[model samples]
Target: MPSQNEPAEPLAKGIIPTAKQQFHDLFVWKQRVVITNEYGETRTEWVTPEPLQNPISLFMQLSLKGWLYFLVGLAAWTADAFDFHALSIQTYKLADHFDTTKTNISTAITLTLLLRSVGAAIFGLLGDRFGRKWPMIANMLVLGLLQIATIYCATFSQFLAVRSLFGLFMGGVYGNAIAMALENCPVAARGLMSGILQQGYALGYVLAACANLGVGGETETWKTVFWIAAGISIGVGLVRVLFPESKQFRQKADVDESVHTVSAKMFLEEARLMLTREWKMSVYCIILMTWFNYYSHTSQDSYTTFMLTQKQMPNDAASRASILMKTGACVGGTIIGYLSQWVGRRRAIVVSALMSGFLIPAWILPRSERALSATGFFMQFFVQGAWGIVPIHLNELSPPAFRSVFPGVTYQLGNMISSPSAQIVNAVAESHFVTRGGERVEAYGPTMAVATAIIALGIMVTAALGPERRGSRFELARRAGDRVEVGKDVEDVVMDAEKPATVQREKMDEIEKK
Candidate 1:
């Protein structure tokens, strides 16, 4: 194995091969043949653990600029999530308001998830070709407009149309926000920051919960929630406008100009190269994301209904249990994310998934509200702990030139594939309904537990077999080269850009030689 401080292997004159080349070099086909003795069973282990570091020291070293970039991404993602969930949580209200069936209203949600990949492709390509700034600005601005439009929508068709457009704009935000955030982050802080950044989704849900509560969770006041969401998103966009362009993007633009002016044609060429060269990685990522999305939706979506109907818990108790679960998700994601830096990203995720498997019995079989809440807390701790690694993991594996699009596209595609998760779980659980207290109750607990256990195992296996580019450089030049010299910081590119003409020339020569 290469040293942690060393660039990934297969670099020559600082140029790394395409994804296809890397896959070819790394691919292995191994038989499970092993000798089993009374003493022990032996098999090959694939883990390559990273070095350990102090938790405090890890966070203390981040520069202010790094924090800003990370916060912006987190905030935008949080707001995006908030808006989406506010609508989802008010599904019953919306159905009543529009005088449609809940199933009909759900079609709008499906449209959003279904068309997000289209949005990701458009915005992600634009962000890469132009810069991460204005594309994101437009995405956020459009999301706010859509939210306002949704509030005024008179007919069910108008509501669906506006929301479909919202999904398009919402899809664009993830790539640009993540690109702007992690592109400028220091490699050392990425794991911890990523964990925190990803929790924005959960945080958004929590905020939506608050909004629902603030407005009495009534069908008539759901429009007010949309208004609040719009204000927040638009406010985020205006603030984003004030932030300067990320230094890494500027450096990439400079390199593109030096080679040939960056254009849509160049973006298309990069896309072609990425899809053709990294198709395997791309497919693998989408599969992992599909399992992940299903895991999340199946575990949480029907859980409250399960608590109310199956477990006979009161509405307040079920709500409390949900809150407890989300809190655990937030805390667990952060801790595991930070720990991944020392333990390795893949290892952390696999461990979290495996640990989650052990908690299922406790999570689902509890009879009392208190026991249920406690179990739910620990259960989500592992489920979302595994999830916390996803954003950074995807970003790290993505091609440097197409990092923005690759992660977003893969993520949205996975979301699209798993869009029917809630429906599937609900249907399956209904079929397994049990007669308890002379009433037919949906078997949500057993169904969820079994499904989650399978997902956890799949996650473990997928993560174990997948690649890791821990400490990978994010800048365009180093990514093109696929090498970062040991002990050298990519942030130095910013300083290089500010150097005198002669010094800059010498640096360029040095880079060319390396």
Candidate 2:
């Protein structure tokens, strides 16, 4: 150790936010793959591990049903959001009622997403501070009510105002639902499970598209879609009331009162402290990766709308495109879950994000509507579809202190970064791209392609340096200076079959490697 007066040497242990006074105490029951003793020898625990026991046992106990439940909740939440996009059509209806331009409808969805992102910050903090269930319940209830209320709007402004309000709750169910799944499930399964859960958003989008087709193209038809969403939200909310709090969050509560919890104020302060040079190295790496993955997701929103209009497609066609995108997104989620099992969620996420940046744009630029729609489906399926794995990856890596905040905040930060993306893309697609005639011939396709490349580059960067919490025992991770680690949703159980047969002792956090 260096003398007090000597400038401190960079320690092997990275990202210390004020040498945690009793940091080891925090890992009392968390899972682990391999642990270090005071003598510095690696020890592996073999006791029958269960949820809240050690990371290994916690890892083992995550059943398929648990993952399925998370998926159901996630599906309901995302589907609600997907359906809200149909409001873009309804937005025009409200405009037309007052004899306004139909184009205003397209803008409404953008405003809604912006509002939803802001709300996620508030509710995400709420999920961390309070329990995850109530916030989820509140989101579903509020979203349902808003869906019903959307039909009653008579003015374009009224429609805009209502939809914007609706957006506030758009991602509400998503954040809490993720927390619930992460907190309740085992560490190994967190990545794939979270991905499965998140696919609900994509599913909702597909379902909404089908509903739009059935409802047909009328001002009244769009109103009916909102009613359908409202009913679904209410039904899901009611079901949520019966779900229990996450077992993971509960573990933190059983600790000594003095070491029990960090206040919300302290939470924010911790996040600030987390920004120090040491932490920034790792966090920034993840942020960059996230920017790429989410860039694809957000740009897809713009691409779907742009392509349909570019095709001069009817409302029903547009609706079908939305459904196809959602289905593709679901495929993306499923693919993430399946592939992350082998490639690892972090690697898979980075790969998918980077590749989606390439493929998602392909969905838009095709010469024919059939080609465009097919590309959109595969883009979401292969590139963006793998998006579902992130929740699992993020949950496994993050410590309890930050779990509630990181994923949603990280996702939203990407959204914020991508905010100017549309305008930049619009400039490039329309005015920036030159043609012999100097006329706009639907710049949507190329814009999406460019956006895809940027997102892909982001994924590439992340793969190079992002943390790997996949299948690594959490307790051993902490002692290994892995505190800042943020794991993934695609359950990395590659080691499940490799577990060691013996153990001598357990540490503050029980970790064992096969």
Shift in Å, residue 149, candidate 1? 2.6
In model 1, the Cα lDDT at residue 297 comes to 71
- lDDT (C-alpha) at residue 191 in model 1: 85
- lDDT of model 1 at residue 458? 86
- The top-ranked prediction according to TM-score is 1
Tens digits of lDDT, candidate 1, 315-341: 556667777887888899988988887
lDDT of each: 0.73, 0.56
TM-score of candidate 2 on Cα atoms, chains taken together: 0.71
Look at candidate 1 and give me any clashing residue pairs.
none
Each prediction's TM-score against the native?
0.81, 0.71
lDDT of 2 by residue, 234-266 (tens): 888888777566543443433343423334554
